[model samples]
Target chain A: MVQLSACLLRKIPGPPRIYKRLQTFRLNARYEGRSRNCYVVGQGYQLKSMQYTRVARKNKVLDFKELYNLRLEAAAEEHGIPFRYLWDGLRRMNILLNRKVLQDIAIYEPRTFAGFCELSKQHQVDQGLNLPPHSYPKIPVNTKGML
Target chain B: MHDRRRVLQWATFARSWWIFDANHQCPFQSANRLCLFLEGKHKPIYHPLSDCGDHVIVINTKHIAMPDRFWRAWRHFHHTQYAGGFQVQRAWQVHREDPTKILKKQIYSTLTGNLLRKGLMARLHLFPEEDVPEGMLRNVSNQIRQVMPVPKTLEDYPIEERESFPRVFEWPEEYVVKDGKEFERQKEYLDEDLSLSKLQ
Candidate 1:
């Protein structure tokens, strides 16, 4: 039970108890490959393992982004518009939305997403973008919505 | 008529930031996809006159794996007004100097018209590898995946499926193959040839 020093604790987030857990994971994530869990690893490799964890934490951002993009793309494909087009179409109609929200709408609120696409299709035809092979349902332009 | 319609469309357009991953993505395909964002071609309300396009922040540009031998065969040139200021670098060399240059250049060419190119390029942000500036990362709410599959490490694969991966054929015991020794021999040959070339 080697008690870690305060200087060693500098710049780490969470309580000391949580930091210990992170430190353990830092060593474990690397050492698990060789069947050496963090606790059994030697003392010298401690700080280095923590640094690896930091770098890996940053890299995890890319992982989340990759997931969000995949979901958005798949949902857009199902809606018969490439995700990019649908996103842009939404932008054109002043309906600002993010990939996560769009993905949720795609899965849970599909009719609403479709309605947004309908408006997007109307805008597309007005601007004359390259329409996909699938015929998009048009939003009926009415006198009431303009005001 | 066209200009008025463009203005009308722009009136209600609410812009946003988009992220694109260039890792292991083809430059041509990525450029085409990016062009839609730059030109606002993704929108039916897109037009030459209006700045209705959203911003794009691209990450993992350093890992762009060009197909075939573009690293050697491709060349980019630079020129200055001085009589002998012309310089050229191969794609590999360009990447070494600045990883984001090729991707930006590719995207720049994909976008149409000189008039809007500068403005459009202003909205395009690129980061080499995974390190993105806080400001660009802050604005990006969503991302677009590359059309093609991005290569992943062995650990990225699911543990359950790794063992279940199908094999096209299994080797017989008599047909055992040496691995590292053959690679070492080829590496030595290549090193010697490279050293000889350097001497020349």
Candidate 2:
């Protein structure tokens, strides 16, 4: 781990001074590759390709309606849980988490997403909340004053 | 006598009166009310065919109230194209540069969907500061008096109303109705006897 830390620092210079101070106190430091640059050795990661992949992932085409339906579908398909159980669990958790963030976690980090679902389930259990079958409301098409 | 009666009728018929103060917070509420009144929505005399509404003069627009977070959070968005092209500007930047322009833009947006919007907007007077020069005020006072009404809201009314509404223009009480320079000037304009050839 100490050798890994030296290699990482040598590859990406000029990290903030506060980060260097934190490194001294870190006993079991695990590097999370979320920063601007992450390096392993003299073989540096291609910065341009990393940025392109990030942008491409964001740009992946998904129909809005399909994406909305997928959330309930995926919960039932993967966990053998009903749509209501997952939804009520999410509501009970009271996380101000957006749908896009949940969708990203569900697609890329299934383990982390499963943990979130479990946390939400525990929250529902503690609150004694009952799940209701999900229903989509019909939205009125606003055509008034349209040119 | 008929003209005097008409003027009195106009004063009585005016449902709302607003006096904008430089010192007061939230002058836009008064501005919005004035815009609605000018749109002829408040008046019984309103006819769709003819444009008839009370004139509005917004005094001391420079000191208008702005929210504390307005400079950072408030952004006005505009698109250069029909699609994705856009630009954003902060409210404080617009205020610091030309506040009157910003006020006029807001007032115009509120007055939309009315045919008389342009005509009503033309009548709006925006003064940057409270102080009005005495000479200009005197010339314009008669016209101001024709439209000006008793103050209502503390938020809408001018700060000067607390001491008694100061007339923006007033004729000197000392001036007699003699054949003086002022009297002759008025007589020349009002002369029914004077022929067109004689005036020429």
Candidate 3:
């Protein structure tokens, strides 16, 4: 029995690291070929594609965060303050609501979202916050007085 | 019902004009209140991205009141973008230059910074005095309540009301009215001081 086990072990040849890598690449390429059309079967291409996939996943998360900001900005503007001021006031007041949650609230419970905006606006007023210079234009000239 | 709904929808989004009297009212407080209307926060259908704010006409900006000694203490800063171009003027000086500036600044400061700020600010009409232009006055359909009530002075009281007020006590027949003569003498001293200051 010991001689038979030794013969079986000797018969199994140890493959090189590149061959193992090539095998993984083939598996990955096959999966990719079945799922998607592109089949650039190679170790480097496999690694690069994996890296790109991770980057795309991260970018998707960032995109969603920005989308939430846009929605919140629109909602906050309705209540009279900008998204920046709303975020600032929220941070200062320690409201701790996340962007996703705030956007959801803005969509589902608009009145509640308005209250949040009003609270932030009130905080800004109380703190004596002012916008940047030239954020608004000067009152127009009215030589004609035809307003 | 569909037609009614359509009409109500139009009314909901319609921009209304508001008139506010700045006479004897604190500009800072009034601006805080006015900013709300300018942002459309007063409406249930207010959306920041939407141009739903109402127009506001502020009359009598010349008579706007400042709290305490802010007229002399408060300062407005300006820079001309040239070397040594820094300039700082007292609130009273700024007001002298432009009577509507203080209130305008207050309102401008209160508004959120965004793309719509200029458009929203343009909707605001400030008249230095009570003389709003005829064309603008015709657009006003509503009035904004003053933030603070104007205090009534002794002159505001009618002579009949003053005389009819119940007296707490009657003075004795022999009591001398010394204040009447002394008050007139004090007035003369005040007038002399005013003249002396003018001369200096």
Best DockQ among the predictions, by candidate number: 3
Model 2 agreement with the true structure over B70-143: per-residue lDDT tens digits:
54456666778867566666665466567676677777877776666788887676777867555434434222
Q: lDDT of each prediction vs. the true structure? A: 0.73, 0.53, 0.76
For model 3 the local lDDT of residue B9 reads 72
TM-score, cand. 2 vs. native: 0.34
Kindly list the per-residue Cα lDDT of model 2 for residues A24-50, writing each as its tens digit.
324113323422233322112344445
Question: Runs in model 1 with CA error above 4 Å?
Answer: A1-79, A82-147, B1-11, B158-200
Residue-level lDDT of model 1, residues B109-160, one tens digit each, is 8888678899999999888977888887888876775768877888899988
Worst 10-residue lDDT window, candidate 2 chain B: B141-150
- The 10 consecutive residues of candidate 3 chain B with the worst lDDT sum are B191-200
Chain B TM-score for all candidates, comma-separated: 0.71, 0.52, 0.79
- Candidate 1: interface RMSD equals 10.3
**How much DockQ does model 2 earn?**
0.01
Question: What are the per-residue Cα lDDT tens digits for candidate 3 across B103-163?
Answer: 9998998999888899999999999988888988898998887888898977899999988
Rate residue B24 of model 1 by lDDT: 90
Task: Write the residue-wise lDDT of candidate 3 on A1-147 in tens digits.
Answer: 455565576655587666666566555755544333333345556677789999999999998776677567667755556688789878987889999888888766778887777666556555668743322213322223211
- Best by lDDT, which number? 3
DockQ-based CAPRI category assigned to the predicted complex of candidate 3: incorrect
